[model samples]
Target: MDTEAVNNARHGLRLLLVTLLLTSIGFFIYYVYRQALPKPLPGIPCDEVAAKKVLGSLPSMFSHWKQHGVVMPWLTGHNLKHNPPLVQFFGAPFAQPTVILSDFQESQDILLRRGKECDRADRTLQSFEGMIPHHHLAMRTNGPRFKGNKELVRYLMSPKFLHEASAVQIYEKSLALIDLWSLKVKTSGGKPFPARQDIFDAALDMVSGAAFGFKDDLSITKRQLNHFLSNGVKFKEHENGSVDFHGFLFFGYIVAGHETTSSSLSWALKFIADHQTEQDKLRQALWEAFPDAAAEKRVPNVKITTTHVPYLDGIIDECMRLETSQTKITVGSWSVDDMHLFKPERWLKTGDSGELVYDS
Candidate 1:
């Protein structure tokens, strides 16, 4: 009687333990599957294939980026895939999907009219805060920190400050770039050389001088140009036919501005080089605007250049539109046939006085 009772009790206890373990495993699996599933926002279109996977759109995005060296095109391509103006995609596992609003007019309206309803994303604020803790970009629009930062930097954007204090520094820095390019031309014997670093250095110099009151002698472009001129240094050509020069790097807001400005300038130069006709027209327009400077065979001053040179303005506007540095949410209208073309004339039109004027 004792042996039979003991064996039966042990078997029952073992069965109970196995049942509890199986139930726990089942609950864990369900929880993970729930987390892995895509959670799309109401009324937003999403990729069906992505919704079936744990990683969602990330795998596709990474594949596209690996092939193209960029993710924006693939991100924006969602607009073409869906008929709706708004689309959502999962950026990470178990994370909320990011909504992409492609309509330009609606996006503008939301940004301008719905400021209170739609505050800056917490993720973006946190990211910026990590890098620039006290900067306005890291704060919410309604916060005191943001308002104080705005007040501090407001004068930087003012017409008087920009035209007087900033313009002078930028003008001086630009001249250094011209001199650097001239030296490069001489050293390279009119052969093509990479100008990305030179452009970046010039941009940094301009920003540092304008923002922090740095002197011309402290400029990166000026220093590099001086080194090349004094040392009789020549550009080292690579096997790929690209030429290289020495450059230095530094790290904040200044770096951010420098990067954006340099990228735009680099794209502008590439566009201008590819379009010889537009380049010639731009040169003529500049010369016509600054007849005295052209006649003297010298570059025009900041004030003169800042004045309404329609062609120059058009070129700049076109370049910025063609290759935007920032990853913006809105997409422009697809109605225009020549939208892809780099035509500066697209931004130009005849004024009431029948003269060429800058029109966006």
Candidate 2:
């Protein structure tokens, strides 16, 4: 090559290298500055492991479960010690802050009284977008749109509507589930088998029966998208491309209903399995409540009058109490009962003030 041409090429290469080096240095300095920036608020900092982002903390900011599935209640059990309404921060840089409300009255005022002042976060809605990308109850924060969506669901869930459209479906599905479980247990030779899938399948069947009348596929149709509650509840951006708004909402119920119930049942089963005496008590309560519905045999015609069954009620409540700890929110349990037994009578007791001191 000619001398001038070679010289020019070398100069260009040096310039490019210098540019890249300067850019790298600038990025590093910017990252350091962001890390040094003051947190969103002064609170008890946690999860120093989370990534730094404007959309920090992801799911933990909404509740207790972090990106790595760690429940952040390492800050728990300090209710009387720390005097909550304590603020705790999670994540890095643009950290998501959480307030732990240990007081009942304060919680009531914030959750029930001043609900309008506190709107749901956007990223939380966005998290559900993969299931219900378009507008649905989970995605809506506030305003008339959220109101209409909730009202429609509330009406559909009303006793009258449920009795007419859904009760029969639930009953039949449940009976069929009992049969399936009977066969499963028999095949297991009375050994413990994984019940998660069975429970999940049953949930899927029940929710599908109620929501879509047993239609399996939920691919979107234009007609479905034009429904009144069809809009996008975006978190950061609309990079999710396109989805039929109506089908999004409908399918969301199918997925979420199954997930929530199945997860709850799994947790309940674990707790119950650990407490065999309570499980026996529950079985006794069940048989007494429905003489026709047997475990090994086909359960015929369960009366659904379970509200009158005390032991069963207690077992269910206790299961939920333990299961909620998985959510990792720090809160106290206030009940007058022997904490050991799966006793339901503890739920019925009154405190010294002649009032029930129920704590969530």
Candidate 3:
């Protein structure tokens, strides 16, 4: 062939190479987008109705799950026999490679054996840190300042401190509750009245006393603490923005300590009320244990001691189990830097082998 023909053939080859390169790049971009996009989870679409029901009857639902040792099929559409709890998160996407441990052994291993593997710096933490700068002491026990403060907290908030504080708070709040109930009953001419508000007041007072060394009067301390938490530290107003780590911890503790404790006590009463015979037994036991303080006026003098009441402890423990507040703690994650945050995709999904995988 002539030199011109050879040059034309080379030019065609160059054009073909460029076309192939462009095609490959386009395909890559599309693939990345698909991987990153938050696709609608196959069957579960948030299920607002189910969520409402679950929240409304949280106690009973948790009780059923605990008793059965598996999430109920009616609620979760899964069972222990065939559909294991591990697959519940198979379809969703998260920032971390999370191992959903439904089995007792697996859960114990992840939560206990390898808890440190899962770090807890997430979007929520950003909000929390902003709201409460001091919340970090509860989470990360690093740095000299944190370490020293933690040691101080450990010593000051020891079991002895807790016991004394709890005893005084419970006794005082219970007395206040008894008075409120009696007054309400008198005003209502002994008719049945809603006890929830009164119970909530007592629980709030108790938690306030324990946490802040004083009852909650919705003062600056309480308002600042709770308001900062509810609103979060608005680091940014746009749909997406960073938050404070301390604020996140504040929310965690509020739920962990205050909410959980109140729910436990409330459930304890509910359980006893459900089982009248058990309640009667408890009343009799209380009287026997505190014979001198059995009278209405002397009730405030009655103290709750561990040795004096084994059954009461058992009941409270059972109530806690029934409440199932333990399983709600979850670790979430998000990109801390702005450059990493712009990529809107990267969610959790199961790998080809049907195992959960993180793609952040």
Candidate 4:
């Protein structure tokens, strides 16, 4: 063969190899892109725009969280947008889509009755496992660890245990909270002051005392009260401010109890403060229920307090229904009307004896 023809043949072979390499690279890239896209489960409703995106609903969720400082509302808002009993969203890139059941009865059935069919999600287990490896919350229901852990704490939920053991500690913490609030009221001189931290501290103290058997001296609410009383420090009324924290270790207990209770109490306080009529009714009912304590200018003990104060029970039930600390799914079909309104009366009804009774 001629030298020029040999050189042309070698150049043509090199061009063919480069073309195959580039084509292979292009196909790999396309394959990865397709795999990264959202995959909705069969027959589940999902946002149409989100299904097309690589990150699915995450970008929109992030945007909503940036604006609102929380994401549950955004997730719940999807119910309104889709108008469905169930909606799915991709929480992360290349993750299985999360199916959110908005119907209250259906959610309850799945969570309570259909345990064999629907168990805890992997994301929930992963979240707890990172923080508390051996905690029962991190384990599946069918797992031996979960059964053993549950057996260990089964007595904690008994009414006798709660009344005999937990109630006294909680009552002491409650007194500390009242004292702390009284000081704040005097210092603020009728001006509104931030109560979120105080509420959280009180809740922490109550939980710590009940769970760990901490004494009154170690109570957060008591310590704060003593600090203000000893120093005579006047609280500065501010729209928003940061407070100093005494160092303490964060635990799964805080996640399981403290945050939930504090958030619920904070909402309860806000709702009562906003509605004067309901507040008055609650006070009147309490005073009437505990006439001796009211006459003596003393708060009722745990026993008396637990004895049905219908209005107070109604207020508590209504507050929990209105601003639940956990994620807000849609209400049941029966109670969907005026669910947004803070009306304690919704929980009150005429009993068989024609007396006002608290209804769940």
Q: What is the C-alpha lDDT of each candidate?
A: 0.78, 0.56, 0.50, 0.78
Q: What TM-score fits each model?
A: 0.78, 0.60, 0.53, 0.81
Tens-place lDDT per residue, model 3, 91-186, is: 222232222344443454565556467534454456555555555423443334565544534633466866677667667666666655565566
Q: Relative to the unseen true structure, what is the C-alpha lDDT of residue 15 in candidate 4, on a scale of 0 to 100? A: 97
lDDT per residue (tens digit) for residues 1-360 in model 2: 699999999999999999999999999998877765435454553344333444455444445444434444534532334554554444445434555665443554565556578655566676776666555645545655776665545665577757765666667666555655555466557877556665665665666677766532331111122221243221111121243435755676665566776777788878888888878877877776666556545554534632356566566666655564333223335554655445554554555887433323
Off by over 4 Å in 3: 1-29, 37-83, 90-114, 117-127, 133-149, 181-201, 215-256, 295-297, 300-302, 327-360
- Give the Å error, residue 348, model 1: 4.4
- Whichever of 1 and 4 has more TM-score, that candidate is 4
lDDT of candidate 2 vs native? 0.56
Instruction: Report the Cα lDDT for candidate 3.
Output: 0.50
TM-score of 1: 0.78
Q: After superposition, how far is residue 279 of candidate 1 from its true place, in Å?
A: 2.6
User: Where does model 4 exceed 4 Å of error?
Assistant: 2-7, 41-46, 77-85, 229-254, 326-354, 357-360
In angstroms, how far off is 40's CA in candidate 3?
A: 13
The true-versus-predicted C-alpha distance at residue 72 of model 1, in Å, is: 4.2
Candidate 1 lDDT over 1-360, as tens digits, reads 999999999999999989999999999999998888888887788998998888999999999999999898987787789968889998888889998887555666787678788888888887777656676767789987778775766666678877887789889998988998988898888998889878887887787777677786678887787778777965432221222211111124464567787888898998899999999999999899989999999888887636889999889877766764533333334346877788887778999999999876
Best by TM-score: 4
